[model samples]
Target: MSDVVYTTTHRVVVPFYVYAGLAFLVATGMLFTGAAEFSGHYFQPHILAITHTMALGWGTMIILGASHQLLPVLMEGELYSVKLAYLSYTFTGIGIALLVWAFYIFHMGWPAKCGALLINAGVIAFFVNVVMSIVKSKKENIQAIFMLTAAGWLAFTTLAGGLLICNFTENILPDGSLHYLSLHAHIGIVGWFLLLVMGVGSRLIPMFLISKYDSPKILWSIYGLINGGLITFIFIFLREAVSVLYMIPVLCVTGGIVLFGFFCRKAYRQRIRRQVDEEMKISLLAVVMMVLPLVFLIAVIVTLMTISADVHMVLAYGFTIFFGWLTAIILGMTFKTLPFIIWNRVYHARAGTGATPVPKELFSSRLFNIMAVCFIIGFISFVAGIVISNGIAMKVGALLLLLCAFLYNANVFKLLFHKDRML
Candidate 1:
């Protein structure tokens, strides 16, 4: 790796963080307003709106931006085209704003349909750009393969979502819309989010730790288990199969999680750097959070097998995956990666000529610590409220989460406006 590996300009990445910040702010507001009733049902209009805001607006948008910058470094090549990156971002940003607005109003009209189409188009643009970049790159590694595969899953997920939106407007699905929602959710969650995190984390974690740990075999196994499990899931889900067969996908996903845990442990044990930063600590905590879903999934499977599928357990599982694990990782990694990009832009020219603040100085660690504590407390209280059906606890949790979001935005602005020579 080089001192600076980002080939994409700051213009490409900065707007994404801006969009993500706005999305997080909006999501926090939704949670605060609907806190008392958010856990009541997963399919409510408000819930759907908030979920898409988090998933597409906050999560997918940031990933797309970061991937454009990181993929070149991972593949040891330059980006194929910056214009396509801008187009992808524009389409995705506009599409998500429209889609979330439509969902918030519980309207399945032309606006929502058009939003879905725009989102699908944006995803297509992204997929084409990434695939072409990989093809022209000199490096052909497992990390690139993981990214390419995740891009495929993203395309499929978007297409499925677009079709679902169309079905809402035109009643195109032979079955109910709810049946396909699960498929769409899983494809986005497991196939796209989980796989991308694992793929990217595998490369970045060890690199950050300054450890010379490499395990191609373990990574290969992790890949096989996840893809195999997802394929089996798609088949069963599409066929509408019943029985214990659904457990197979759950087990495969769990197996991947377990293997990843081991992989992280190996990386930690072999790490040369003794002191890990707060950002990395939060990211490592996310790795631990990944196991919570497995536990919830077990409960979900058990309920399905014995009595009935419990909506509460299902909600818990989804919540753990998205908010607990995925959100934590993204929040943590944003600080870890974003500072470097900003640093390169601000201090690259001043290197050796004068004293330039390091990337770590771009933001306050104390603020990050506060945000982390609030996040964990808020997440736990919210989940507990859901489990116990307590509205007060949920409200408290939402308020705390809102505070965390505020702190997050504050720190982000601090970094964005950081001066080379701080007083």
Candidate 2:
């Protein structure tokens, strides 16, 4: 069906799309101006700011908005509370801004602590809404489970983050915030982002590919392995174990990812649709992009077995996950998803009546293609720069990424402001 089962009000969902677009532009700008920071420690001020901008502002914000609109559809029920969704947005938006600014200025005072607390509160609001929605739904699926679990993890991540912020000045944390940074990052990445993406992508990918293949058993297995891996990692982290101890969870998560890849392959092979769109192709490429980080991560673990880990490997691993795989998937899927959300607002009632624009036509494909090219070149160059500590390549890459971000924002805003027209 063209319409979502219970479509959220445009007022509720559109703001997120707009905010995410602006945040992406702002993040790229920071990336360009702060290109030098890429050579330094990941724990530095500007690096943290840019990371949060992409993570909370661009990534989490978009996911939150999409989830609010989609959960009801996936559950075949209504959202638990629109008010809660808006509350999550308000607190998250202001909190991200405060946090980003504080990080940029290297401020570890009230603004930082308050920002962290606000973000934690926002995650709580989201977690409550999601759990209640799942509980209320009569027919529950693995997707719902994945989402609810991810929400819980997000709450934990933010709570840890807040404590990390507090630890900066209070100095109450056991091993200093730096020691727990890996734990914080992994909790957010593996537990929250990866699981949530798998959940949403499993449903969306098959649907878009026109693959009739469905396997609850395989999905449940993926869920088990991924979460199992995450739990093991957290345990190892808390125990302060190093070397081969880390490998256990790493292998488990890797095994889970391998299963996921196999599942996607099966879906693709079983697909009834012969022709995939450009957007779908990019999304598929993103699925392939997942492999890069796995390789880098293995390298990082091996390096850790030695006296010191290679900083370049650590940075590239992170960059690959966030900017490479995650960004690719989001970039591809935004057009695929957002156009439909916007199209429903404009043409839901008139869909069967006359010549209404298809979701694909609401946004410019040319802009998307050009942006993809920029992303490809810039991503490779930026990674190569970081590996070799080449300032010139890094700056050039950032500049291209900034241009790509501009085109992306332009296309997104174009859809947001799309005028109602009858052809």
Candidate 3:
């Protein structure tokens, strides 16, 4: 019932946006250069570089920063240490830069190993900080548990990735290194990213809607379904089990998504604030996007059993999960969360004095709409290009996506530098 917003220091959050912006620029350039072509396989050097850029540089970076700010709010307590937060960011930024460079050049040398080590340490620091905060907090919530579990998965992901890197040098996994890549990717995507989103989104969506709705039971069910699915997946995946057994985790994750969709519907129905703003509307669109990867996964599984798994379908599935679902949610939530943080920093003290610009007034909605349209077009075109093997369509889609990234950065800058005016 309180409108209080808890956040970490600006130093912790702002640097993350800077890294995300740089990552977006790099990804757009990769797309423009055709390094991102579908090419019927997921494990080329350039593609790996691009994926790391988006995953580590943009997605994980933002999540790391935002979680520092959001966890205190979720836990109803202060961060364990501000200094640790800064250290985590520094190590992660350096690690990402080095790793990306190594991948770009197709070299897995000492530099890559060092980068992997640094990243692992950084993640460990972050995990420790979050755990400490959770332990110290008096208020307990399911959202906090979601975050802790996600952090644990992230640690597992990094450890697996480090082994993957080692495989290049030592040839540790003689069976075939590529086979383990799916485990690494899924742990990061579904275990870390999807679970974290569900945890955070469950709380934020209702709050933003001004809905007093609270369903602890529904949230617990979703948590159980996702983690249960993931645990089962790890067991099946490790044994190199039968193909059909894979469907079990897929079904569990699908159930979690369906339950989450129902939860969103209930929140919307209960919302006191009608006429949802453009920002929240975009966020809601991400909820729809969540279903897309499920559809793609079903196609992938069907093809796997019947026709030996089409490469294009597999690529489509990854594309939908990363770009369509994860990116959309991050894009939407960035606007919703960042503006309030900036507005509080700039105008909170001046609030009862004559007049002040509301948080919504900090940026241009027209620009947001343009970015949204471009993103949808680009996503659809890019997926179609992959489906049909059309290079030209892919190029066009990449260009549009590049434009969307530029517009997004521009708007972020606008909010960061908004000047106050007296009314």
Question: Clash number for every model?
Answer: 0, 0, 0
Q: Decide which is better by TM-score, 2 or 3.
A: 2
Query: Would you estimate the TM-scores of all the predictions?
Result: 0.97, 0.97, 0.96
**Top candidate (lDDT):** 2
Global lDDT of each model?
0.87, 0.88, 0.85
Give me the runs in candidate 1 sitting further than 4 Å from their true place.
Answer: 1-6, 352-354
The residue-by-residue lDDT of candidate 3 on 1-423, one tens digit each, is 556656687778888887887787788678668634575587777777878888888888889988998999998778998888888888888998888888889889987888888889888989999999999988889999999999999999988898898888898886566889888998998889999999999999999999888889988999999999999999998997877898999999888988898998999999999979877887888989988887777787788777677788787888787668778887888898888878878887797775888788898888988998888899889888888888888888888888888888888899889877666
- Per-residue lDDT, model 1, residue 343, is 88
Range of the 10 consecutive residues with the lowest summed lDDT in candidate 3: 31-40
Instruction: Tell me how candidate 3 scores on lDDT.
Output: 0.85
Would you give me the overall lDDT of model 2? 0.88
After best superposition, candidate 3 residue 342: deviation in angstroms? Answer: 1.0
**Model 3 reaches what TM-score against the true structure?**
0.96
Residue 416 lDDT (model 2): 85
RMSD values, in order shown: 1.6, 1.6, 1.7
